[model samples]
Target: MHLQEWLQLLCSHTGLKGSESEDLWSLLPSLPSFSLSTSSLLGLGALASLTAYWLVTRPRPMHPPCDLQAQSVAINGDPNCRRSALLKDENLLEFYYDDIRTAYDMFQRGVKITGNGPCLGFRKPGQPYEWISYTEVAQKAQWLGCGLIAKGCQLNTQQFIGIFAQNRPEWIITEVACYTYSMVLVPLYDTLGMEAMVHITNLAEMTVVICDREERATSLLENKEKGLTPKISCLVLFTDFSQAFAERAGKCEVEVLKLEQILDLGRQNLKDPVPPQPQDLAVVCFTSGTTGKPKGAMITHGNIASNASSVIKILEGSFTFQQGDVSISYLPLAHMFERMIQLSLFTFGARVGFYQGDITLLMDDMKTLKPTFFPVVPRILNRIYDKILGSVTSPFGRALLHFAVRRKQAELRSGIMRNNSLWDKLVFNKIQASLGGNLRFALTASAPISSTVLSFLRATLGCLIFEGYGQTECTGGCTFSLPGDASTGHVGAPLPCAMVRLEDIPDMNYFAKNRQGEICVRGPSVFKGYLKDPEKTAEALDSDGWLHTGDVGQWLPNGTLRIIDRKKNIFKLSQGEYIAPEKIENIYVRSVPVFQVFVHGDSLQSYLIGIVVPDREVFVDWAKEQGFVGSYQELCQNPDVKNAVLEDMRAVGKEAGLKSFEQVKDLYLHPDMFSVANGLLTPTLKSRRTDIQKVFQQQLSSMYNKTAS
Candidate 1:
């Protein structure tokens, strides 16, 4: 049956007459009832029905398994189903879960878990690398957990431990120790300013803090005047403590320990067993608040374990990992996505490679590790694609490159590559070399990447760049685009353990067919609740346990998910027509020549905009080649540059199928780009819309007031 027909049938049979008022309660009447005595029977019946449906609808392999080990359990049922069940059952001994408890247990069982590795820990230009194996990690955690207990860390209750540090092995060690001690790990983004850092630390009521270096120690010490709580009694650094530096600090004083000192304590207390439950609160990761202050989302061990197992199962069929796969760690571990990925890597016993310092050396690190998997934001992929396009020297070269891209895209769509064209081996070979030539898969999130970018990546790289969608509240990944199921612009199917439903706000002007609406999710991976904010927590999680994701999304025909924009980012024009700034901004930014677009005009008749940071290098080269002489600044202000940019915007707008009202009527170009230091972007590189609006308020007003050319 056709997709529309299937949807219509489901709607009709389920009594969902329209998008509005499609309540599950209305459909419940047609289902079987259950009394206390018959509830088990009813559940079994429902499970059987679901299994049958899955067997009929789920995708099957073209070739049957020759060996039993090669065959995976079906999504529905089979003999291997018991193995799958054992993997998910919390009570089962065979359950190899992904959580701090599992990590601790693995360490106790003599697994060589390394805290400091050549890739992630402290490294100098020409020094011998230092590392701490799994036994040491377990030993250190036991001591730290014991130290916390000795220093008044209690059990079966919520306690906070602030982890303030850069990406380091000690960060994970501290977090694991917190879990072992039944304390909540509050991960603070190291790049956060003093105010946010203090606010979160205090809000979480952190009793102890583990700092990565002297800089974090100084931040905490300097900010002590703002009233440090008595509960926070310890300040430990990964580096050796300096008594002189410690004496300079004044606040609610606490005992300080160096990394080695803490480990020494743990080593002495190695015989003690860690105390924690599967249901205990494990970590409190903060959300990236684009609109307001970041909120701490409480995640439990069960949540982590369930989510990780579900992800592992989904990836098992395609992306298999052995005992020692290589992963390069760079993304902030404070972010839930990175944290989840780290846990997965550790649980799978993968070798993690750390970058030198920042993303500038990511290419070098990728070459060093030759990693099989990496997580990145869309900006990184887009930049790489731009660089690839920029390298082409002639019209014929560009044509051949485009031809290779198109053919490769066709192969991806058709899943058959009968024609082994020479162009792929010759022209695309260089593109593959740029990414270290060993990238198997990449996971993109934090923003929407353009279909053009996604297509280019898959074609040239010969690997699937899986697009995942989730937020800090959902533990970073809720949906992922599967291999061979690539869509032009979809986030992909709902992950195995997640249930997704769109709540249509038809009264609002932005609703589209299977399109824009609040994305609601119910899954084990969802947060327990927002910390210390019950009202906000209630507002986000409904009574039925569905988390209102706040972002708007649509289900494509192929069951892939497409994120349109954040519901909060949508602003109305004078005509009451809402404009999704992110969608529009993504369209403009993907034009290759444009960079950093901000769409504004909250009360204007039509949207007016200002864009900053053009691809000056690319455009300047183009201008010089065209015999247009002047500096980049002179060229930016040149009539030709303005005309070219405006034309590019129009072309992109038309291609994206945006309406006239949604298009940018007038725009002002800024010479400088937004950056972390400029207070224009978040640490994660997301535009601070409110801050941008306030900063460019005058420029925006002028653009709107002035008539378009």
Candidate 2:
């Protein structure tokens, strides 16, 4: 019988909801479908019958109709890699099929579809995380948008809102509010020093600043008072004003608005829902330039939305997101990698938990949160590996783990055994249990991961590790490693959203037809250009709109891409900090008593190395003051003199406003200076980077080993 018919007959016979039946509560309000006045009124027999029928009658998990036009994508070297399926949307879930018009629109739709469902999970210090339902996020975002408009802040392209805060629920809420009001979001890294904060805000022409702490607010207002910035009208502080900045706050001309005050002011604006168009600028993200100035990348709403859509299309059924799936986010939202992934997961109704401010507490947060999805960097994964290795006790236990790891590695390489092994049940299961036994997948970016580490994590936690390749300009992902594609060397195949082609860089000995060159990308994911810097915009984004990534790449046998080298001098350190050697050298040579300086770095290494040629007079004077009775060459060889020079160099870097990651950690003082005659510098007085690296190869090696030891 039909559900309605069955209900009607049951009610009529039992007199549970009928007028003739004994009334459980006569004063209760009535509804047409059923009465929820009391749970005891519904008998166990009725509930059991209903549950049994529902379970048996529910539809099985089904695959969508096949697409005849789908093609195969190949990766060259790895035979274990399965031939990837083509542009096949049929296999995608219902969420992927929707043509997401705007970010705000998708957010509201998510709210309606997932009623009372957890969209965001937040935790306080010394407390467990509590789920914030979709309704609450939507309501709060709406109110926040209204509050923004109610203030002097305008809801148009002319208005730029600076978000100077850590990664938290409030950050996401502020982003959503920006989308609704069509205001451009200028994200400043919370730990970014004062100069960058002042530079970015002034360049973006931010009218209102929504910051989490008083120090940041004071920094912005102080910059204004110093005449570095023209004028900022409003300051929205998320935290209380501390005594540290209270004096500055009182003297500042800008009006202060509390977050709660804005919310209350927005209570009257629930119905004003003006969302941004796809073409409108959503963000002006500033990336550090090699010249010590920050250049803002203008990312539009369509750029971000399209990039997310393309990723979902390529990864369809390979990665599935069920409702209530918990995702623990540890990366900062100021960067595009974490920001775009958060939005994509949100659209599919996953519960996203933001990590607390302290990174050491990440494991504790994960234990309490029990996350199924984790977005990580290589450092985080390496730390977890270290922890696991430390926990292994006896030699016998270590041998067993090694054997199990080898067995799993062989099985994966051969593509023979797809089932879980006995090791998982006997030993590896403990790692899974520690992570709440639910970590299904993890995504890593910014740098390449060790294949050994990758295999160990896959075997230990039973989770797929997907590593991707892209710049901030590409909206976080251009090529993505697929499930079961444990290919070596290369990251993965290109997504349909962007077309990647290798352009010739003859100076670096790479060419396009050889299947390797400068990695250039062109698509909807590419940023419009560097904000307000048309010259740089022209150089990076030409007439055809292809972004010159400046990183050398090669294609694998199966059509995947690998970064072989970087033609550009800038490289990322192990901790994901970008270090431009030339930029550092320029700042140091001007202040330090150095005739010439050559900076070198390894992406797989944590710190920087400096090769210096100290000035003759300054070096002798400093040595004499320190009572070093020797010639300049002898003084240069002295360890004590080297330490003093290193301290002086560090002071130069500090005064020049370089961040800790950008500063030189170690140095080698040589008596000989770099000159054009020595083949280290060109006739134009530019230091030949490759030549310098080769000349001081031994010195660089010694410096690296000193820190390692």
Candidate 3:
């Protein structure tokens, strides 16, 4: 009963009004369940008074006075990095951002406020480079949109346009032009060869393609004549505006326009450009298919805008990015990853420099540009690591590098210095200046990075190396490393706008309960399924909106994700034990002497076999020490050398916690490393297991026969 009701009953039963009752008795409830002694009642009153005082005067536990205070600008609901409730149970890290829907929307707002500052930087032959302001970029897009409309290009009617070129200022112009007219962009990578380009153009049914050079235009024309891409109706050349350009256009029997001509045409007919709807198809990015034909992923404007905003918010939470911050662009803009970075840079009006076709000149470009931000791939980072350490051959030099690293680590651990002055001056500064004196951070992606390499770069260079993991269908890195992420070999966490979950895969024994399964994702960042291939779409995406990323993943102890292997790559042995060959390969390849390892074992085989490619430099030194010096090919033919490397491989497997059955019994040394040109490696530097198996079938068979004998 309530206190007031109980008091009334007591007054009626005792024949005493409340006014006549003793004031001390008021402390106790008058209900039959309350039988408080006088002393007990006094104690209860004192406890109540203490609690009231504490509630009124005590400091709030959540907002205690501290030296470091959070700075947040509230956008939408919350602008700070927040715990995403969708992945809260899984403990995935993510950030919340301003609610923005399309790339055009963000660019429109940011450009108006930032004004006509430098937005893009490009190099010219035998002359000084030039920078295009945000005003020019937008104005050029408007003109291009007008020209496209004048050429009978349909807006928002799913007109696919192709960009058959490398990174350039014109590429950005073409992209914004396409977006302004609601044309779906189909970016063709230069590395994808002419045949892949023709096939993609055919599949995409491109109305017009923009080419930066004459060579690609000639190939596209030849392919068009050969009926590879019959739907291609026009070619707009950015350069080469001579009679030959017109001749090529006429010879191909297609309407051709120079980029300048298009811009002028648009200038004559310029009007207010149509703004893109949120649900409009932004781009159709094709996957680099290692197994078969590529599939086009239909990514929408919402997808790009949402992902860009999330990453922007993430960068803001970690560090500061101001207007005119320089970013080096060297990776293929045709790839969605680079394109996403380019699109995201608009939010801060960051100045981006386009790298010339030559990779050898990247360092020069970096030194000249003094880029503050760089998104590099693993192969590049690995190359940088080797080039710096390659000269540390003397024992004294190696010991010094080691000692300095240890000292720096110790000083940081003991709080002696916030930034280790000794390492910074003697070691890191030179390395940092080599890339660019102004580099604040760098990103690594495209393939799995060795944690050893990742850790060494951070330790020796004293810079933050954030690693990201994603696929084309997932709009590039759905998960990126956070500021405080210390773990190696893990993708940081899903983007804040995305919801990720682990789904069970029973055949290979992957389970969500074990925090290991096929990674399934659902969010604004996810694509709108494959274009023109509903069957493939149905297989990849389900009714529940989860896109089944064929990759198998495990959550680290701290909730970061480690990609274990492709689901289809796992194989079983005759002994009925499942073996993940990729996992074994990942560990075994980390050995300094081992360059590339492709672990192979059939369902009928008892033990795994490895095709090992030894690091040639290390192999030569070891060979010289053994007094068996010869060419690399001669050393691979030697059984003793092969056995010695095989023994080292076995030790590596054991250290990685592989079972005895999973250990490589024998190895055949490959004379050369796998490369994309060899058809054994993907463009992203991933080994194509099926291709490798085909190439080494005879060698593997001989190894197994020798083992059996």
Candidate 4:
């Protein structure tokens, strides 16, 4: 029987009417259909008959001891719920079991979970909006899960399936289906060059890879040339490949399956039992590998589910929204941060609208969705802040505006007004209008954001922009600043059920007090281990299960955590003075019109050197205002431009209280900014320090070659 027919029969038998029946019926249109043998049909009929009998004879309402109302708790200092709410339930494994079962429950409860939208790609443009719904998502996941089972995917052992692609519905569906089947998903950044891609694939021992498009399909197929191909028996393409690439891929001697084909195979057998418990590994997200080859962090279903549940609980306390709140999902799903947030949205039954394309079109997409929530990285926020500040052309106007902003920010911090000021309304109201004016929070991560930008957002946007801290191993968020706790440079307290402690390294000066040291964490949200890398896994996670985060951090008196710098990135100069370059660079980047900044002084005698990308428009405008008659190219090499940056750097250094040896003394201008496309940055937009050091090795050497000549 079709899903609609089955739903009709069930609803009629139950006497469901009014809004309840309508709600249930709305969920049916998107469900997938399947063919069953007479015997199997009889068996399912018997189960359904029993279910209906129980429903009719059992208690009315059939509500659990707990409900959504009980789940709502204030995230920012509400004493009532925080004092009484339980973090975990009776079952030890309940956390893991919740991941897949909750999804099924939500579907049964008439939630619209997923949709198909117009491909609306970045590289390709001019496509109309096409969409897929939640029913389609659930059915497709079951189909894909069944297909994997049919293909002899091991129920035991570490079976890895790689998704080497960009953001798409297929990526999310495949991951969900894999979770249902207890298969570990390995998500690879599409921007990874061949070497890194091959290294990660081999390390994970992925047997099947779901490529996002023909480009990724071709890249993975060509990996055979590097002699790195292992038991990778299947290559599934999420997009249709050209006949030319297909023919060439066929020559490579690997079997290829289109995404639709796999889904079709699975849909043919939809009633198969859901496999595995939630504690089972669900994904293996690779680290950015700033130091070396990336290691696959084994994030389990329980870890993901727990994190999502925690975030949902926290969000409910501050925001008032129902099962169908809207969100715009544009960040890469490959990242743990986005994945966790997306999962949380699913649990809440939010309508997730995909961005039309890159962030350049994010505002346009926002206008369409009028999203209540937005997840972004610091780079995007920094750019927005810069653009807003740069718009004030007159120096006097800028000073007056900054003064008003500061006063308004102080008023906001003091809880004077929860809304925008009159001056702010007059000045920056259009800025708010551009964002659809429905934004509840701007969630930022991936790097430390500046206080100036954060303050400006809160004061002007009249919405909280919370900062969160986590790694791939922690299933996204370990700590998040509460809406009311938007203090400068604070990452906030650890989430409930998460245990964090610092391991003091005496040699590290930053960790000298307040239990400052390498941040080590142990929690239900922590990953199981690295995929097929026991040695590295052992090195990272201890026997007792604390994962050494490699980040130096300190706990403030208020219980918030502040990250000092990456342990590996802190270097000592020839004078034996340790320099935390990331901290210095972050400050300078905030103050200067630089798109990217890197500070280096390793083994150097005295001060630091910097490589910076000038904010082209701002730099040009500044040059024109200063009476410099030249183009951007000439301005880039002009002494005046260098002097401006140097002065800004010096000012920032003075404000930050840096010693002479720690200050930036020499600098170079970069013609281009670091980006994922150029192999200069990770997919997350973090600069690859090693790569940058190698590329600028000569220039770095030149800084010290003349002994201060």
lDDT of 1 at 164: 82
Model 1 agreement with the true structure over 76-185: per-residue lDDT tens digits: 33221111221333232213344344434433323444343322333444433345565556556768877667666665447788888777677777877876666778
**Candidate 2 residue-wise lDDT, 161-272, digit = tens:** 8898877888888888888778888888643457767778777887788899887777788788887776677888888886646556556667777788888888876547
Query: Residue by residue across 1-709, what tens digits does model 4's lDDT show?
Result: 6556666787788786676567666765686676556786788678767765655543222121123223222234421112112345322122432434433343322233334322112223444334556666667778887887767676542778788776767777787677666677878886666777888888777778888788777778778645577667788888787888767666766678888888888777665546655567777788887777788888776777667655555555455444546667788877888777667666655656677547678777776666677888988887778778877879987987787778767766653434446766666677677776777667889889887788788777766677888888888877766545535777766665466667766666644344578887777788888777899899889999988887888766555677877776888888788877887888788555567888988775766888888887687776676677677778778867777777777787788887777778878877688887777888788888998999999888887774488
Candidate 3 similarity to native, TM-score: 0.81
Candidate 4 lDDT (Cα, 0 to 1): 0.69
- Give all candidates' CA lDDT scores: 0.67, 0.72, 0.73, 0.69
TM-score of each: 0.80, 0.70, 0.81, 0.81
Clashes per prediction?
A: 4, 9, 0, 8
How many clashes would you count in candidate 4? 8
lDDT (tens digit, per residue) of candidate 3 on 1-709: 3445444555555455343444324655553454556676567557645544544443221211111122111123322222232233433322233445676776665576576888889885444457998889899988988887788788873888888887888898888888877788888765566767877887887878889878878788888778677777788888865677667668667788888898999999987777787688889988777666678999888888767766665555446566757888888776788888777777766778888667778888887787888888876787777766775888887888878777755543332322236567776777778877777677888777888788677666665567888888878877777654445778766666565667788987888778788888777778999989899999999998888888888766554577876786677899888887777887887665687889999888899888998887677777676667778889988888887788777888788888899899888898988886677876567787777889999999998898889
Better candidate by TM-score, 2 or 4: 4
Q: Higher-lDDT candidate among 2 and 3?
A: 3
- Candidate 1 lDDT (Cα, 0 to 1): 0.67
